[model samples]
Target: MQKLTNTIFLLFFVAIGQGQALPNLDSLLKLVPAAKEDSGKVLLYINIGQQYESNHPEIAKQYYREAGALSRKINYPAGIIKYINNYTFVLNMQGQFDSSLLLNKQAVEIARETKDSINLGKALFNTGTSYRVRSDFESAIRYYEEGKKVFERHGSEETQAIANDILQLLYYSLEQFDKAIEYGTAAVTYLRKVQNLPFLATAASNLGISYARKHEYEKAKALFNETYNIGLKIHDLNAQGSSMLNLGDIALQQSRYSELEKYFSKAEKIFLELDAKESLVISYRGLAIYYLFQRNYPVAAKYGEQGLAITNELNLAFEKRKTLETLSSIYIAMQDIEKGEEYLRMSTRVGDSLLSETIQKNTIEIEKKFEAEKKETQIKALTANQKVQQLSIERKNFLNKILLAAGAAVVIISLLAYRNYKQKQKIQEQRIAELETEKKLAATEAVLKGEEQERTRLAKDLHDGLGGMLSGIKYSFSTMKGNLIMTPENARAFERSMDMLDSSIAEMRRVAHNMMPEALVKFGLDTALKDFCNDINQSGALKVTYQSIGLENLSIDQTTAITIYRISQELLNNIMKHAAAKTAIVQLSHSEDTISLTVEDDGKGFDISILNGARGIGWTNIQTRVEYLKGKTDIQSAPQKGTSIHIELKTS
Candidate 1:
């Protein structure tokens, strides 16, 4: 359920909007027909598309494409921008980022022409998703925040809901679990409508994931189950399968293979029926891992092959690679080292290609989102100023009339003087609030720039200063040691020292990589995460398992990744130090909407309530780290029962 809970399920994620409340396309058109003008026709199509986008994306695409065409035909810049916003929603669902970006480009062009603050905000928000899909968190967050400012002006519940949800996701992805939960809780205010049930389920599920990440298994499980209930109510099979998969994943991490088997089976069965290839692949792979954990080698091999076959048939390179990776692991366990190595090679090839493509896409998406947000902010400021000025004149005119009326009806005015005074007072307060909010936006603009500059500085410090120093030290040590020969005992000691030095250097490199990954900066977070996890798990002291659900790629920001790493580091360190645990499990999973990091330890357990509340250094650090990222955390522990931490962040 937590896995199912993120963007599509949590953050205004409508791969297409679900819910029976959505009007049918024909019904929508019949209700809001074209008004002859090109703008009017485009608007009609947009409305129809919203109606059909969930159930019939092809139909939605037709309407949206038509709307885009009509807007261009009429040179109605507003229409063009608005229609494209609608179209982008569909594009995100269809995983057509390229087309989405193209349309978003057109929308940006029109927003510039019309200076429509509202549509500019909507377009900016839509563009954020394009960036998010490409895994460009910085750009995505930038646009989302920019959109929030625009939406704040309009103050529509729906737009505010969207912004709040995006913020929740941004925080979650960053591993600021507490802030993620806090802001996510704030989102519920605007997303109060039951029609937004799917979104609520996602948030709740994400809420659960965050709790789980903190090792609050009970709380996490509860939220997950709640999310599942909503999915079932909506008859959203995709959500249902995803929710179950996460729960199954939890079971797997805890070595509750028996339980995992059941959940995975149910999830796979549903996904198989729906032909949901992505989910099926995830479920089957999870099943294979479960079987392998139980030493049911034959079953593990069977499911691994099955999952691999489907991924290959679909040409889903991502899933295909994952399945192959599992197969390789299975073979290794079965002592078929050569076969294992072969599968590993195939997995690597596919993974490398995916990594390269993902990086390019994420970089481009971030650029587009940044540009779009910059444009949106300027327009929003200008529009806000104009609105204030217009309102000032309207107020003056209204006051003059009110004075004249009051003079003529002094007795009536006196009778309602308190009400009239209160009304005026309320208006004045609202005006002051708006002015203050505008001030904040101005400040935010400066802050955003400052943060980027700071990151640039920090990256330089880590790469040029620390990294160079480490390289120099390593080279010097190597040179001094190259010609030295010694007694066997002395040689062994020297080698051990060298090993420590090497390990320390590698550790520093990992830190530098975290500070600024050339690959992440080059390719994006997904591949970097996969490679990093693989590297960590290869030591064999731990089992780090990961999966992705709906997203072909996750767009995320650098800060978000850093925060996640820090949180994860804290988790792993705690497990290693205190758990006396024989095995550790880590998973990177996402759904149509969200991405999360989960670590479970089958080590010594302590009462989770007491330990988490103890304010120990590790506890505080994990909490602080998650909060800084504006995410949520859950921790679970019990004596002789192991410990598990689940953290889910909402991402759009």
Candidate 2:
């Protein structure tokens, strides 16, 4: 898992335009156990392709490419499907999203043929990670989480753990520290149990970063130290180096410059020894900051230049932005305000792009009740573009027409054109404003309609299926209890029957409560989710912790609450059935216009593909419910990784 991310980040270091080459075909082809005929070769390729998903994705792709060709040659249905996922992962890594998407579809077909959740989740995870790398965090998270469902069902701990790590990072990027920590903590726990030390350290470092960002310095320090120690124990020099680097960052933030410098030096030593210049950027920046604090201008400038050069070579925008900030600080300190401001503007531009990308990635969601590509968004975007074009054209055209006319004609044409120009500008502004309003309205209507539909469906289901069954069970138990005689043996049997009757009654109550969750409407969303989580917590299957922010009665309408409630319930059901999780979190957050809810659990996850075909009907139902609500849900998990379900609703 760690290797996959490292490869992704490191590729920027290797070359910018040139693509990656993977020997997956050879590796997987060898896994076939030397079956001379088509079956042995195809099976070998498929097995190897699965293995390459994490450690050597490029290699995995080649295996799949070859496997697909070989399978088609011999008409091996399963082999063709296996290679399809590998091919998708390869394309995804190379940033060919559209191709990756098409390949995912092909992989899905093959998974259905083989009835394999493992391969199915792989396809979904690949697609998801591609989006994540593209900075479509929300969509990426959605795909990864959906894949988790498949992993949990298919029983792939490695993939599940990997998915959780991705989620932990995604939430962190979103500045949702609590969710980030929750998922990060769960990820570490799983990887450690499975002896995945390298990834474990990565997860710990991430958790530390989350805690640090949240300003829980103590927790962050502990997690970082833990990660550092694990890295040492595992002989993972890279992880150890990164851990120390993060430690330096935390220390610097806490204003412990001494410790910060020490940690950075230690990490720098490792990176320098290994010639990992890209990894050295953080340490260089840290040293630059230290020197700047001490008023050592030349030293500070030197270190800053080094950091900038490395980042530039790597083409890491985020890193480059940081370097620019340091450069701006240096220029300001040197009494060069103009230079400082130039760097400042550059940093600002980069920061905006980075933030925008992160927001689009982490905030937008799939499994939504409404169209993710909403009409309002479309109109506003189109209007904004058209306005720019119109302004440019009008500026030139009006002048041309006025110049071509003579005397009175010129006067009349100029007046009319001027009027037309003003009117067009006015109309464009109005359209923009209206489009903004329409976007909000579209979001609101989607939530309202989706919730109403779910409530109606759940109501009908309770009235018909579970409700009737519970009633029949109660009647049968009641009749049996009434028939018991009063002898000692009869008394014991009667007591047992009563206990059974009581249990049934309790179960029925739970069912009824879940179907409607009256608290959602009466007490509001926060209290209702808490109550629901408490019920689940008592089951001992998992511990559910819930949090809410600005989630008072202001933003939650009946339809919104109900829709969120149903979606939450479906997520819980998925966890119970799939995620071998010991603990979970349900959080609700609201801004003035949006409502976000997340249900995260430390459980065994499954691939998303398997959820529809290989796993069961639960996820499909959950997905349908989310779609009906016109809100959005992001389901993330991998084998043994855990599951994170994110729901974002526009309520205002």
Candidate 3:
């Protein structure tokens, strides 16, 4: 989980020649000679650099160096910053963290001198990412936050989102899941708003892993599925394979053996097809876990060995460490005590080495931070002394006038003090009101979380405990039916009892599903709502006509989507019980910035004015949820007519 998995993000920013085929070196060289302007040559060089970035970092580095030299010769600050950042990107990818950080800092200084906010943000982000790769989370967060503020001020939504996404990953690694979820959710919304498909997919993947770490498996699986589908659409095989491995991990955790096998196998095949050895390491690890779970020691060992071999060949110390741990467990389970001890020792040695490396990086980061703070403090002290000297000079000049203005100043000061007191009073009142509102919102959130947790616990209890017992009872009844010979009347009684038992089992499943629908967990809001409407329609109690636009393709945050679903469910329940509606229409509209829900019924209605006076818990719950979401809601009703409820929520 400490691994950043930021290759997709790097590719998104560096793959400038992604859509078009890369020109040959000969053609690029010909164009370079034909370019009359140094800027044009620099652009060509950068383009060539991007073409070589993924496959040939050394070549890309040289191209970027050439571009930087040309930009410096032309005195193009923006161009200099650009090429330097590009060069730093290649160094960053090559694990040259110290060199990358130095170059990025140089780019930042140049951008600051030129007042290039965009490039400054880019440089800060790259520097932060390098720190993140080195396990210097505090430094990474500091730079990322600074970059985020710069992008926000410049209205660079895509870059701002990328910064936030990286921050989320950092928070996740730091085990601050709540903060991670907050930023992760924000990043996804911002990226989707900008329609940045590749970054959005990566954000979703990172968010899913965060949720998985927090044991939110259902939400995690949904996000992994989303990333997988997005990767398919974008033709990103690495993203696809990574998401497949995540899905397999979720299935493995849930004990869904068949699904686990399917996902792992698919992931392995994709990695093999693409020859993605790094990703293949993860696939092999998943396969090892799968086989270990099945108690197939031999196959687990094989997969574990494969993972180790690849990690060792590629010099992936982290992956090698993980593979060693897995092999240790496998050998221990196989009762090969001597081999197990050897693997355990090897794992310990690798773990210690990684820990020491992290400690060294952290020490360097702390020293850097200390030096920066020291410089800032020294500058501040100098500024303060200068200010004091200036004040002394001003005092000398104003001494003659001070006596004359003192009386007038006293009166003015009195008035100003009164005004300030009044302002403070008003501010205090406003703050009090805000605090009250926040307290209520906090209480509401707590209640909602508690309800969901209870629902999860109850669903699990019903499904695994009571449901299993009932299934056992049913099986016992079948055996009894096969073994017992009875009169027709006795047999009829026995059959009726069996029928009742079956009904109970079905009822239990229905209750559990209602508590926490698997459809909602697995398929998301769109499918869950449609299935809900279908169930109502099939019952012939109230005819439900459901319609949706743009929801199928939408990637809504799971928590938000579930809140909308619950609101819809409550609305339909109200229509069924209170409105006496025979038919209802539920419409969902999804857009870039807003999600709107409409529920209309064709039954006898009441005055909308009475809604506020209504003593129904259902309306209270709906209002609380809508307020919690910071959404707008409207209810319209008339006697002998129909009722309509409309809700609109801002997506971000």
- Selected candidate, larger lDDT, 1 vs 2: 1
Give the Å shift of residue 231 in candidate 3.
2.8
**Candidate 3 residue-wise lDDT, 407-463, digit = tens:** 676566556655755675577567656755765676566566556655765686577
For model 3, the local distance difference test gives: 0.75
| Worst window of 10 by summed lDDT in candidate 3 | 10-19
Error of 1 at 329 (Å): 3.2
Question: Ten-residue segment with the worst summed lDDT in candidate 2?
Answer: 11-20
For all candidates in order, the CA lDDT equals: 0.66, 0.65, 0.75
lDDT of 2: 0.65
Error of 3 at 12 (Å): 8.9
Off by over 4 Å in 2: 1-109, 135-138, 156-163, 233-237, 269-279, 334-342, 345-440, 443-652
* TM-score comparison, 1 vs 2, better candidate: 1
Q: Report residue 487 deviation for candidate 2 (angstroms).
A: 99
Q: Assess candidate 3 and give its TM-score to the true structure.
A: 0.50
Report the error of model 1 at residue 552, Å: 45
TM-score attained by model 1 = 0.51
